[model samples]
Target: MDKTLRRWAPLFVVPALICFIIAFLVPMIMGLVLSFFKFSTVTDGVFVGWSNYKRIFTDMDFISSLWMNVRFTIVTVFTINIFAFFLALLLTRGVKGTNVYRTIFFMPNLIGGIVLGWIWLLIINGILLPKGVTIISDPKYGFWGLVALANWQNIGYMMVIYIAGIQTINRDLIEAAQIDGANSWIRLKSVILPSVMPAITICTFLTLTSGFKIFDQNLALTAGNPARKTEMLALNIYNTFYTRTNFEGVGQAKAVLFTILVAVIALTQLAATRQKEVEA
Candidate 1:
């Protein structure tokens, strides 16, 4: 049976491999090739070597957007995970109507990003109506607005993951901690947190990437106003690609760089988190 399954493994994997190559690998390779060439379209191409990449270095908007996303990622990752973990703890504690509360919290995650952004724009504007301004009126407002929107949408999802991790923890461990005179706080610190590292890892990765790659919310919420100040990296890349003419190669180059940046940051986060998990 094992030998037969092994023999058929290539057959089982071939379709997915072919699809991946055709859909992703081929396009990625083409995009990379295009990055080095100037083109109005794929067919009209002229090789420009490193000029497009050099332009990225002088692109202050790209730099600003990159920084904005970094700050946003830091704020959201911390806020979302910390809040979700506590919320998960509360819900896991034999609370009444846990399912209902979970549903209420999780509903925001179901909304599409564009829809979410509009909903939040209305809600936030209403809250700040007396201030005589809007989220788009100030970069700070836009920044915090994005953060709040992200937290509201994502907390419940992370909470669910945390709840699952919490549930999987051995009840015997809790009992032992209690018997050994460990208080609730101490037990939570020592046992609960360390045990839920997997959930932390998953939530951190999701929240971090989501924060970095946010485009629709940035578009609908502030549209990078009051003059592209609130634009995040994804939105910036988009503006470069579509809004600017004769910069397609430069835009493509930016995209390749963005991909590299995301890959590096994500891998670093995973390695750092897994190391801490092991140490814990």
Candidate 2:
């Protein structure tokens, strides 16, 4: 049976592999290749070497969008993790209706991103209407709106991870710390935190990547209104691709650069967090 299963394993995987190649790998490679050429369509592509890359750097909108995305990622990552960790700690205690609360908290994550953006847009605008303003009326408002929307959606998901990590901690270790006359703060600092390092790493990575890749929310909420001030990297790439004619190569170049940027940041974050986990 084992030998038969092993023999058929490749057969079972081949279909999925083929689908992935056609759906993702092929397009990704094509996009990378197209980034070095100029064209309105694949068939008409003309080799342009590094011109597309040069145009990407010179585009002020792209530069601003990249910076905005970086800022949003940093802010959202910290806010979401901190809040989620605290909520996890709370619910893991003797709290009543924890299951209900968990369900309620996590429901936001179940909503589609575009829908979430529109919902927040209405809610935020309703609040700001009293002050005679709207979310898209200013870049700062749009920035904070995206931050708030991201935190609301992600905090609950991160909380679940934290709870699982907290539950895995040895109660005996915590009791041992208490017996040594360690206060709650001391125990939390020296034991509970270290025990939850894995969860922290996972949550941070998710938040970081999600924050950086934000697009639907930015689009539904602001669509880079008031002169593209609130545009993020993903949305900027999107606009460059469709909104401007004959700039598809530049857009593709921006996308390749965006992919590299996200890869580097995520790898750096994982390395740093994994080191902390080992130390802890």
Candidate 3:
């Protein structure tokens, strides 16, 4: 039976392996090769050495957008996780109508990114209009606007994960802590928090990646108006690829850099958090 299963497993896996190679691996290798040359299409690629990479550093728009995304990610990851953790704590306390509240909170996550952006845009602009400023009128406004939207979209989802973590905790440990005369704050720190670290790690990773790669919301909300101050890395790469002529190679180079940045940051985060995760 084992021999037969092993033989058939390869047959089943071969189709998926072929699809993976054709759909993902090929395009990735082609893009990397294209980044070293000047070409609008793969067939017409002309080698230009490192010129494409050099241009990216000197481009102010790209630098600004990259910087903006970093700042936004820092803000959103912190706020979203903090709020989600608190909400998770609140809902786990035998609160009335918790299921209803959970459903309501998670509803925003169901909205499409573009539609969510437009919804927030109208609401934000309506408030700022009375103050004689708009989300696009100032870089700070745009920055905070993105932060708020990220928190709104992600907090509920993170809360659900946190709730799961909290539920899985050993009640015996919590009871023992209480019997030892531990206060609410002490128990929260020594018991609940350490137990929930896995959930925290997952939520932080999701928010970090989402914040960096966000495009639809950025597009529908600000569209990088007021001279592209609010543009993010994804939008910048997109504009470089489609909006410019004879710069497809440079755009491809920017994409490779973006991939490297996200990979490094995510791996670092995982390493840092995994070291602190306690066994359940």
Candidate 4:
């Protein structure tokens, strides 16, 4: 049976491989090619060869959006992970109604991003309206609004991963650490945290990537309002592609750059975290 399954493995893999090529690989290749050309449509492109790339930085909108996105990603990644880790620690203490608390915390993640955005929009606006201001009234408001939305939505999910990690820790090891006179902070720093490094790696990767690729929340929450000061990289690419005339190539170029940027940052984070896991 094992030999037969092994012999058919290639056959089983072929269909999914074909689908991947069709669904992702082909478009990525095409987008790369189109990024070098200027055209309103894919077939009509004329090779401009780096002109679109050259114009990317000259657009203030793109620059503002990129900067905002960087800040947003940094803020959300740290805030979400820290809050989630502490929440996990709290819930794992054999607390009463922990299951109920976990359910309530995690329910927010189940909501759709667009719906979450609009929900927070109303809540935020309701608070700010008394001051005669709205989320879009200022870029800082929108930036913090995004950070809060990201934290609220993602902390629960990351908490669950952390809980799983915390639970897997050997009870005997913890007891031994306590017997050796290790305090709570020392145990967390030396024993529990080291044991949970795998979960940390997973949670960090998810939050980092999600922070960078966020779109619907940014759209529904602020829509890059107040002269596009709150714009993020994804929405900026969208506006550049659809709103502008004769800038499709530039949008494609921006997309290629965005992909590379996210890929590099996420991979670096994974590598760093995984190395820590190994050392731990």
Best by lDDT: 4
Instruction: Show model 3 residue runs off by greater than 4 Å.
Output: 1-11, 273-280
Estimate the TM-score of every prediction.
0.91, 0.93, 0.93, 0.92
In model 1, the clashing pairs are: none
Candidate 4's error at 4, in angstroms?
6.9
Give one digit per residue, the lDDT tens place, for model 2 in 1-280: 8888888987898999999999999999999999999988877999999999999888999999989998999999999999999999998886889999999888899999899999999988998899898887889998898899998999999999999999998889998999999999998899999888778878888888898888999999899986999999999999999999999999999999989989997889878887876876
Worst 10 residues of 1 by lDDT: 271-280
Higher-TM-score candidate among 1 and 3?
3
Ranking by TM-score: 2, 3, 4, 1
Model 3, span 39-114: residue lDDT tens: 9877999999999999999999999999999999999989999999999999998889999999988889988889
Q: Note the Cα lDDT for every prediction shown.
A: 0.92, 0.91, 0.92, 0.93
C-alpha-based local distance difference test score of model 1: 0.92
> Residue 83 error for model 1, in Å?
0.6
Candidate 1 residue-wise lDDT, 1-280, digit = tens = 8887998988899999999999999989989999999998888989999999999999999899999999999999999999999999999888899999999988899989999899999998998899998887779998999999999999999999999999999999999999999999999999999899888888888988888889898898998998889899999999999999998999999999989988987898879887986887
lDDT of 1 at 137: 76
